[model samples]
Target: MNILAIESSCDDTSASVLSGDRILSNVIASQSVHIKFGGVVPELASRAHQQTISQTVEQALEEAGISLSDLDAVAVTQGPGLMGSLLVGVCFTKGLALANDLPIIGVNHMDAHIYANFIEHQPEFPLISLTVSGGHTQLELVREPFDHEILGKTRDDAAGEAFDKIGKVLGLPYPAGPEIDKLSKQGDPDFHDFPQALLHEGLDFSFSGLKTSVLYYTQDQTNDFLEEHKADICASVSKAISEVLIKKLERAVDQTGVKTVVLSGGVSANSMLRAKTEEMANRKGLNWYAPHISYCTDNAAMIAITAKFMAQRGRYADLEMRPFASV
Candidate 1:
């Protein structure tokens, strides 16, 4: 079966064509307009999708050498993202499904992130997955492809959001997570000792205190000082954030009888986090699953792959399914 997927739940407007387990084509149109704002603006993002969705889907179909008529089904991200952006994709996808006379599947964005591992590796269920994205950070115990028991999640700000907010304080550009992650590699992580958030409650996590700590540390700083110390500060922030994530992931390893751990979501694109996760996973002798940098952010291949599973499970949504901005 050939599946065409759409993912416009955020700043990225993406589409991909998948036939069985192989992807025929994958295309992503990113919004460069958010750079000036230092982050995504929902209305602006939705508008940008409106302008690019058709062209992106067209390019994907062209690259795949297939028309919309060849698609067996249409899949789209349904929730856990910007409402306006999600609505744009959903409405367009619903219309396309109706025009093509194909079954439509609504996918959970977070679930799609985890299933990204399926794009490269086939680590079966009964394992622990740490999903870290711009908007979400959570741990899930997977007993089946569709059955996920959330083990831990951020109580306040998500790891990626924290990265961007801290970047704003340091005068970095918008969408600062990737930038900070890059600079952390060159700078000394131990240059500044940032506080790691320690919340001892079940398996849940919190990053608000750490966010506040970073904010307070810069309260007395001048603009020149911020500019001079930005790189080191970013490195310190990345270190602090990764420490919390690694510690909690380790806890999940000990709590669940599962040895496999999957690192996913947008923040999963970070080099420091990936290195730390890989190191800890190796040290503990656990099987690890993580998506490539391309799959780490919002993309349609993962959405298409996820829809393939949801389709097999008899999980199809009708015209009434609405988007959930938050998971």
Candidate 2:
């Protein structure tokens, strides 16, 4: 089945066309406006989605060599994202489905990230999944193709949020995770020791304290101090964050005895996360799956294919599903 998907749950305005599990075309229009503010502005994000979603969908359809009428179903992200962003996609998708008389599927933003593993590669059932992104960090045991029992998740700010907060303290650009990942490779990973917040059982993570650690470390420091240790600090902070995650992943694997581990979401693009994950998986004789850097962040292809997965299960949502602004 051909699925038309839209993802505007955050700063990215994206559209994609998928045939079965294969993505025919995916177009993402990221908002540069957020860069000027050092963070995402929800009000502005919804407005941007309204302006760009139409063109993005058109582009995706063009690239896929199909029109809206040719689509079997329309899929849209319904929650766990910016309300303004989510509404733009939901409302637009609902209107399109009504106009074309097509079925609509509501996809969870986080679940779409998990299914990202299915788009590029398929692993055996009962695998451990670690989803790291700007808004979420979770460890789940995906026992079946569509069933996810969340094991551990962030109790406060997510890992990507730490990157942005630290980036602000370090005077880097908005969306700091990628910037930190790119720069950390050039310096020492052990320059400074940052605290790792170990939470209670069930895989709950907390990055709020870590973000505060960076804040306190840079407190009362001159610009020269920051400039001199920029790379090292990036390496240090990246090191601390990655270390905590790998430790948790190792525990998850051991606890579940699942040899297959899949990584998804935005922060999964971190070089340290990738390197450490590979090392950890290899040493344990387990299989690890991570999507390409581009797909690690938000995009519509994941949503489209996830919708296809749901369709096979006879799972579809009506227009009643609502949009949320925050976690």
Candidate 3:
């Protein structure tokens, strides 16, 4: 089956086309307006999606060498994102489906993240998925397709959100996770021992306390001190986050006795986290699956992949479906 997918759950507006199980094209338009604010502005994000979604969809179809008439279905991200942003994609997708008399599938944004691994790898069932992103962080137990159990989730700020917030404190640019990751490589992680919260707990994750610790640590430091030790600070914070994640993941593995692990979402792009996760998995003799960095972030390819699974199960959404801001 030929399917088209749209993802506008956040600042990026993306479109993808799939012919059966193979992806034909995936095009994304990222919003730069949030850079000045040091975070995503929901109003600006929705407006940008409104302006670019159609063009992005058209480009994706062109790149895929397919026409609208050839599409068998249209899938859209329907929840766990900004409401206005979700509406933009959902409305557009619904309209397209109505006009073409095709079926429409509403996909959960988080499930799409897990399905992203299928783009290049056949992740085994009964696996552990560490889904970390700007808006969410959680560990999921995947028993089968569409059968997921959320073992633990962030109590406050998500990993990617913490990265950006801490980056702002360090006077870095918007979407600071990548910058921090890059600079952390140049400095020592032991420069400062940041706090990692909820360690005694089995699988739950927490980063708010770590963020508060960084805030307090910076309050007594001079500007000169911060500037000189920026790399080390970044390294220290990155290490703290990675350590917490690894500890919890290991706990889940030991408790569940599941050796197959998958990681996805924007923060999964962090080089330090990826390396540490791989190291831990290897040390424990666990099978690990992580997608390419492109697939790690929000993309329509994963949405299409999820929709394909839903379609196979004879599950489809009616036109009355609504988008939600949270799971």
Candidate 4:
């Protein structure tokens, strides 16, 4: 079946065309209005989606060498994102589905992230997924397709949130996770020790304390000191976050004995975390999987792939369905 998927759960307006598990085209238009704000503004995101979603879907279909009439179903992110942003995709999809007489498949943003690993890699069942993003950090146990048991999640700030918050404290740009990752490669991870909260605790994670620590630490330093050791600071912060994530993943593997482990979500694009995950999996002789960088963040390809699975099971959404803000 050919599916057209839309994702507007956050600042990005993306659309994708998929046939079965293969993505023909994935188009994402990100909003730059939030850059100066140092974080996403829900209203601005909604407006941006409204402005670009139509063209994004058009580009996706054109690139896929198909039109709306060729699509078998229309899929969209239904929840776990900004309400206004979700509404833009959901409503737009509903209109398209209604006009084209196509079935509408509602997808969970978080679920899409996990299933993104399946886009190119066929991970076996009974797997553990570490999903880290700006809005969420979670450990999920998937015993089978579409069956997920959340082992743990962040109680406060997520790993990506911590990266951005800390980056702001260091005077970097907004959405600073990628920036921090790039700088960390040239610096020393052991230059400064940052606290890893709840490192020995249960499966749950916490990065709020770490953000606070970075804030206070930077306050005590001079401007010259910060500029001189910016790379080291980023490296040290990345080390602390990656160590905590790997440690928790190890605990989950020991507790569940799952041989297959997957990483997903925006923060999964972190080079250090990806390397650490590979190292840990190799040492334990386990299978590891992650999506291509294109699918790591909010993209419609993941939603389209996930909807393919749901469609196979005859799952479809009603025209009256509404968008939600959380899982």
Top candidate by lDDT: 4
What would you estimate as the lDDT of candidate 4?
0.95
Q: Candidate 2 — which residues are off by over 4 angstroms?
A: 199-202, 325-327
What are the lDDT scores of the predictions, listed in order? 0.89, 0.89, 0.93, 0.95
Candidate 2 local distance difference test against the native: 0.89
TM-scores for all candidates: the values are: 0.96, 0.96, 0.98, 0.99
Off by over 4 Å in 1: 199-201, 222-225
lDDT of candidate 4 over 1-327, digit per residue (tens): 999999999999999999866799999999999999999999999999999998999999999998878889999999899999999999999999988899999999999999999899999999999999999999999998789999999999999999999999888999999999999998899999999999999899999999998899999999999999999999999999999999999999999999999999999999999999999999999999999999999999999999998998998998998999988
The residue pairs found clashing in candidate 3 are none
**For residues 160-264, what per-residue lDDT tens digits would candidate 2 score against the true structure?**
888999999899999888889888998798898899888334467888998998899888678898899899999999998888888898999988899999999
Kindly indicate the candidate among 1 and 4 with the higher lDDT: 4
Score residue 114 of candidate 1 by CA lDDT.
95
Q: Which ten residues in a row have the lowest lDDT in candidate 2?
A: 198-207
* Model 1: lDDT to the true structure: 0.89
After superposition on all CA atoms, how large is the RMSD of candidate 2?
A: 1.5
lDDT of 3 at 214: 94
Q: Is candidate 3 or candidate 4 better by lDDT?
A: 4
Report the Cα lDDT for residue 15, model 3.
Answer: 99
Candidate 1 per-residue lDDT over residues 161-279, each given as its tens digit: 88888888766787889889877877778878987766445667777787788899898788788777777788888989988888888898898878898889999989988899989
Position 142, candidate 2: lDDT:
93
